[model samples]
Structures are given as C-alpha cells and as structure tokens.
Target: MKLSTRIALWAAAVVPVLVVLAGLLLLPLVGRDLRHQQDARLRDRAAAVLPSVRALVAADTRGRPKVEQNQQRKVVDAALDSGVRVTAEDGTVLLSVGPQPADDRAFPTAPGGPATVRDRGAAWRVLTARVSGTGANGGSGTLWVSEPGGLAGDQTAAVRRRVLLVAAVSAPVSALIGFALAERATAPLRRLSRRAAELDPAAPPTPGTGDGPGGGTNGGTEGGTDVGPGGAPFAAVRSGTAEVDELAAALALLLSRYDEQALRTAQALETARSFSSAASHELRTPLMSLRTNLDVLAAHQDLPPAERAEIVAELRDDHTRLLELLTALGTLARGDLVEVDSFGPVDLAELADAAAADARRRHPGAEITVELPPELRVFGWEPGLRIMLVNLLVNAAVHGRGGPLRADPARVTLRLAPAGPVALLTVDDAGPGVPPGERETVFHRFHRRRDSPGSGLGLTLVAQQAALHRGTVRITEPPTGTGCRVEVHLPLPDAGAPTLRLPARRDWITGGQRGDRRP
Candidate 1:
C-alpha cells in the first residue's frame, strides 16, 4: 500500500477502537445517573406524602373512618406516579396504592431513604419515612415510595445504540480525512523521485565550471553551487521540506562522487593498456638481440678466445640494455598511475644537491658544481623530483661533450633559486648544447642520439616527473654558450600548503608528448 493509504488505514482502525473504548468507559456512568435521578424522584415523593400518611394514621387510630378515607386520598394525590404504601407503628397495614412487590418481604424493610430493592426479575428504588403525631398512641406510621429500574434500563440501551452508531460512522470519515492529508504531505517526495530518475550522471559537465542538470559546480547545481546543502542528486532541487531536500542532496553528492571515480577508473584503464603496448613494442628488439647473441655463443663452444670474448661482451651489453629498458618503463608506468597520497613537501635545493652528488659518484671523470640553500621546500612527490633531477644531471654528464672552445673534462653545474611563487632549477653542461629545433623532442620516449649508450627513456622519465609535480622543463643554450641548459620551474608551497595535482593528460610514454611544447 502507499504510505499515505497505510497511514490513513492505521488512523481509521485506531480511531474507531478508541471511540468504542470511550463508550465502554462512559456507558456505566450514564446508566448510574439515570438510576440516581429516578431514586431522587422516589425520595421526593415519599417526603411529600409523609404528612398525609401521619394524618391517615391519626384518623385510623382514633377510629374515625371518614377522616381516614380523606387522608388516604390525600396521600395518593401526593405520591403521583410512584407506588405508595403506609403501615402503623405495630405493622398494621393502613393504606396500599399503585405498584408494590408481589411479596412485601422482598421490598427493603423500613427503607429510611432511597435504597435499591430487588425482587424476582425486577428492581426498584424504594424510600421510606416515619410519620409522627403530637403524643404516644396518638398518630405514628411509615410511608414508602418505589420507582422501577426498567425506565432507566430502556434509556441506557438507547444511549448504547447511539454510541455504536457514532463510532461506526466516524471510522470511514476519519480514514478519508487522514488519507487526504497524508497524500498531500508525500507529494513533494514523489516529485523529487521523478526528478532524480531523470538525472543522468554520464551527462557531460558544463564548460567553465558552471552548474548543469545533474552536475554540481564548485558546491552548487553543477554550476558550482552548494552541492553540500539540502539539494541531493542535485543541490539545486529544493522542495521546501528539510528531510526531502537533505536526502536529495546526500544522494546527489554520492552520485557525483561516483561519476568522478568512474571517470578516473576509465582513465586508469586506458593508461594500463598503453603501458602494456609500449612495454611489448620496446622490449621486442632487445629480446631479439639477446636471443641471437645467446645462440651464437651456444653454437660455437671451441671458438677462438678473442672472438668468444667479443661475443660474451656483446651478450653482456644486451642484458644490461634489457635491464635499463625494463626499469625505465616500470618507472614511467608508476608515474602514470601516481595518486595524491604519493606527494609531500620536498626541499627542492636538498633534493637537487643529492641528485648532483649521485651523478658525481657515477661520473668521477667529470667535474660537478652545485649552488643552492640547504632547504628550499616545495609541495611535491619527493621520489618524482629525485627521478627528474637524476635524469637531468645524467643527461648533462653524458651528452655535455668537449667544451665549446676546447677538449676538457666534462663539467656540469646545478643551480637552484626561488623566482616569485615558483622554484627555479637549471643544469648547464660544458659540452655541446641541444639544437633549437630538437629541444622539445628529446623528452619524447625512446628518443636518443645514435651514439648514446643509454636507454632513450631517461629524459622521458624526467618529463613525466616534471609533469607529475605540476612543474615544467625546457632546454636552452647555457649562459656560457658551451652546452645546453635544462631549466625547471615548480610552484612554491603557498601559506595554505595545498597539495599539487598531476597533469590531466599524463600518458607521455604513450604519445602524449605532443602537448608538452610551449606555444
């Protein structure tokens, strides 16, 4: 049943039962009142006739028949509709008129005032009063008045019938009234249900952060209104009912969150597919070379030492290449899959100094210099920053070839300084610098110099980290004009210290580098 109908029915059932119970409670009091009134009337009649009864007793005692007859007639007139009886002091019957008990003994003996007297299948209120004269043996007697209970019983039955009729009639009337009110109350909920049913979570968000039909904007109706308020499913829907609006708002919030998570899930799946495809394509060439070198060594067990040594060296180089390729690919996949939890405040200067130190250890043949404070912090993922810095320093040490003017040991300089709300980093090489046209392409996956001996994904890793940190990287000629300068800029942590977000399109290892250029 509908909620309104159910409520109405409950009220209907309960109201009739309550009326019946009230009737039950009141019926007895009504019946008693009728009986009491009858008793009072009987007592009044008895009082009125006492003087007449005394006169009759006086007349009878003196042996005066004419006076006695007159007194009897007077007593009858006073008693009216009630039965009247008179007796002498010694129990002599003086007068009997109207209704009386079949057996006199069944009446209340000498009833001084109103009293209930029961006989076979009958009931009465009987009142008795003493009659007195001036002297002893002069005039003394008792008068009795009686009224039957049947009159009150009849009236009580009539009242009971009326009470039952009213209870029966009110049941349906109350039910109809209750149902109408309940239906009116629930009308808003039904409207809300319809609107919610029409909501399409997949509907695209409006351009420029405005509210839409199903999307909330900022906090409002997909236009960034108060989605957190009483509008659920869409905070813009208000029905003027607190509970309904609150429920709708809650439901809208849940759906909006679900839609958000759904989009993220779809993006994650696409990134996973790209990672797999790239991994397979890039690993094929190295795997083939490994297989060929292994086969050559296996086929010639007694080959000359020099030839064997050369083959063994080639096999080792292929194995190393496979390792580097897998590591770089794994790192790129991790960057693509990074979540907000992986970020924290990292000291950019400290991170840079550490990266330069590691590079120096890796390349003792080159001279390295680092210039920066010990702690210039920026909100970022420490590991991603470390990866970016390591790549830049390694690239400089390897490719910053003979000094611009003369052959000299490779020299690399790392610098860090704050620029407005951003941290600036620059790595300058003393060797040949990057060409003007190829500066951007070098960050693409697997792009390398023909003579370079490292995996081409190093600079790609650098680009991924920079993008993940909401930072930027670009190549230009160093101040000295000898080698390329890799300059980076990362937003500094504000007073509020909010977390930085990754780029919206982060599939750099899967042909997303086209968006990496400055326009």
Candidate 2:
C-alpha cells in the first residue's frame, strides 16, 4: 500500500484509543469536582437554616408550640432545595423538610464535613451544624443539610457521553488529516520514481550530450543539485528533504558502477577476440616450420649427421619462437585488462637486479652490469613490472650483441635511481643501436628486425608497463658509447601521493597501439 494510506490508517486506529484513554483519566476527576460542588451547596444551605434551627430549638425548649411552628416554617424556607433535619438535646425531632434520607439514624449528630448517607438505595451528602440558644444550659441540637448524591453522578454521566462522542468523531477526522499531510510529503519521492523509471539504462547520459531530461547530460551540479554518476545525467530534485536527496545520490552511484562494469565487460570481450586473432596469424609460420622439420626427419632416416643437426636446430628455434609469441600475446591481454587494484608498491631496484641475474643465467657468456640503489619503489603491478624488467634485460641480451671491433661477449648495464618524483631506469647495451627514425616504431606490436631472434613484443611490453605505471619510455644514444639507451621514468610512491587512476581507454591488442605516453 501507499505510504500515505498506511499513515492514515495508523492515525485512524490510534487516535480513538488515545482519546478514550484520556477520557478514562478525566472521568474520575470530573466526578470528584461535581461532588465537591454539591458538598459546597449543602454547606451553604446548612448555614442559611442554622439561625432558624436555633430559634426552633429555643422555642421547643420553652414549651411554646406556636413559636416552634413558626420557627419550623422559617427553617424549611431557608433550607431551599437541600434536605434539612433539626433535633433537640433530648432527641426530639423539631422538624424535617425537603429531600433527605427517611431514616433518622442515617444522619450523624456532628459530621466533620460533607459525608454520604444512604437510605433505601438512595444516597445524600450531609453536613451537620450545632443549633444552640444564647444562654448557658440552653437547648442544643444538630442541624443536618443534604443534597442528593445522584446529581453529581448524573452530571458525570453526561460528561462521559460527550467524551465518548469526541473519541468516536476523532478517528475519521484524524485519518483524513494524516493522509493529506502524508500525500504532500511524499510528492518528491513520487517524482523521483517517475524520473528513475524514465531513465534508459542502455543509453545512459553522457556529459555535453544535451540539456533535456534523460537526454544524456546535466547542466552541472551547481548549488545543491546532484548529477548522476557514470555519465547518468539524472539531476536529483532538490526538495529540501534529506531522505529523498540521499536516495537519489545512492541510485546515481549504482548506475555509475553498472556503466563501468559494462564497459569492462565489453573491453574483455574485445581483448579475447584480438588475442585469438593475433595468436592464429603469428603462430602459423612457426607451427608450419615445426611440422615441415618433423616430417623431413620422419621421411629421411639415413640423412647425414650435419643435415640432421641443422634441421634439429631449426626445430628448436621455431619451438622457442612459438612459445615466446604465445607468452607475449598473453601478457599484452593481461595488461589491457588489468585493474588498478592489482597495483601496489614494487621495488624497481630489487626487480631489476633479479631480472639481470636471470639474464646472466640465460646468457652466461654475456657480461651484465647493474648499478642500483638499495631501494627504489613505485606504485605498480608487481608481475607486470617483473615482466617489463625481464623483457628489457632479455631484449638487450638478444639484440644488444657486442660490436665486431669491441669484444666477443655482449655488455649491458642496468641502472636505477630516483629523479624528483619519478624513478629513472636506464638499460645501456653495446650493440648496433636502433636508427633515430625507427626508435619510435620499435615499440609497436610485432615489429622486429629481420635478424632479431626474440619476439617483437619485448620493447612493446616495456612501453605498456611504463604507461601502466604512469611513466614514459624512449630510446636515446648512449652518452659514452655507440649503443642504445632505453630510459624509463616511473612515478615514485609517496606517503602523500594521490591515488592512481588507470586509463579509461585501452585497446593494446586489437588496435596494436603503442603504449607510449602521449605528449
């Protein structure tokens, strides 16, 4: 049911009960007040007739019947609506007048105040006063004045009826009022619902799309107005209600998350397609070579030892190239789909040392030198950084051979140091350096020299990871030698550094886009 209707029903149910409870408390007080008023009237009447009662007592004591009868008339006249009874010292009833208890025993000789006396199912409030003559040893008697107890009860009953009538009347009236107020209060919520219903999830609002409602844009969230997240242009109504405003904000946030997830899902699907396409296209040559070599070996069992060794060596190279190609494709896909949550503080100095050590193991004949500080940290994906370091060292090992005029073994230097807010890493290789014109193209996906043994993805991976870490990578001429220097500058982790925000647009696999930092 509607909120307003619920409120109205609750008010209707509760108001009458509250009114009745109030009446229950009020009834006793009202009854007591009526009784007090009656008692006061009885006391007034007793005072008025006291003088006449004294005269009657005196006249009866002197044995004058005529005066006693006249005084009795006066006492009855003064008694008015109340009941009166006069008695002498000897217990002789001088007079009885008006409404009263028929039993004389019911009246107290000297009542402290107004007291109730009952006779034959009837009740009265009685007050007694002393009626005495002026002289000593004079005739003394009690004057009793009373009003009916039922008068207060009747008044109380009338008030009780009125209270019940009020209780019965309040139910519907309170319900109507409550419903009207509730309806008015919920108007903003209803409007919010209507707007939310009109929103199109498939085509959520984007900034600068348009100004119309749900047209994919909001003017701005200036003042207190709020715009929805994830390009949802829902401008919440500023209705001076906290609950409604908060609900609008929460809804906007939810939509934002939905939009983000949808984008990620689309990107994941695209990355998967590119991974399959690239793998098929690149692996075909190596696979064909492997098969041809294997078929030749199977067809010719009596071949020369030299010819068999050459075919076996060709098979090994093809197998290694095929493995490297698959590994590179997988790494690129990972980089494209990586989330910022996977990033953390990674020590570049330590990672570079490890990569250099691994390279030395692989190329025992090559001389590798590393100059790094004790620690150099950057906020980045640890695995990606490790991949980058290994790729850079391996690229140098394979392509960075020593010149014919220099030495037999290749020489490479890996260096790490902090430069301002960034950690600078440089790999110097004593080999034929890349040309100035082709330096930029070397980082593109699957681009390699004819004689290069490694997959072309090595430098590409280096560029991808540098961009991922909010860094830059570029090739330059070595300062002191005729070789290539690949310099990478990655941002350093700091205590007060702002949180890193990943790039929203990534299509490294499908687009074959170079991962260089855009100038």
Q: Per model, state how many residue pairs clash.
A: 22, 1
Residue 398 displacement in candidate 1 (angstroms): 3.6
Cα lDDT tens digits, model 1, 1-519, are 898999899989998888889989988999999988887888688778877787788888888899899989998999888888888888888988877666688666655767777888897777877778444666787777877868788998998898899889889998999999998888988887776676654563321132221112322234323222122235446778888777877776665555445544655777678778887888888789888878988998888999989988988888888888888887887787676678877888888888988999998887889999878998788888898899889988888767445357778899999999888899998777778889888888889889788889998887777666667778888877767899888888897853443443456655666414320
The TM-scores, one per candidate, come to 0.65, 0.80
- Which residues of candidate 1, in runs, are more than 4 Å off? 1-250, 253-265, 284-319, 342-353, 371-382, 399-402, 405-456, 466-506, 509-511, 514-519
Clashing pairs in 2: 205-216
Least lDDT summed over 10 consecutive residues: which range in candidate 1? 207-216
* Candidate 2 lDDT over residue span 1-519, tens digit each: 999999999999899999999999999999999888898888788878877788788888888899889988898888888888888888888888888898888888765789988888988888887778545645888788888888998988999899899989999999999999999999989998987777666663344333221122212333434334334456655678999888977766665555556656776898899899999999998999999999999999999999999999999999899999999989988997898899887887899899999999999987899999999878899999999999988888877787675455778899999999888899998888889889989998899899888778898888888876778999998898588899999888778866776654456776655635531
Query: lDDT per model, in order?
Result: 0.76, 0.81
lDDT for position 335 in model 1: 80
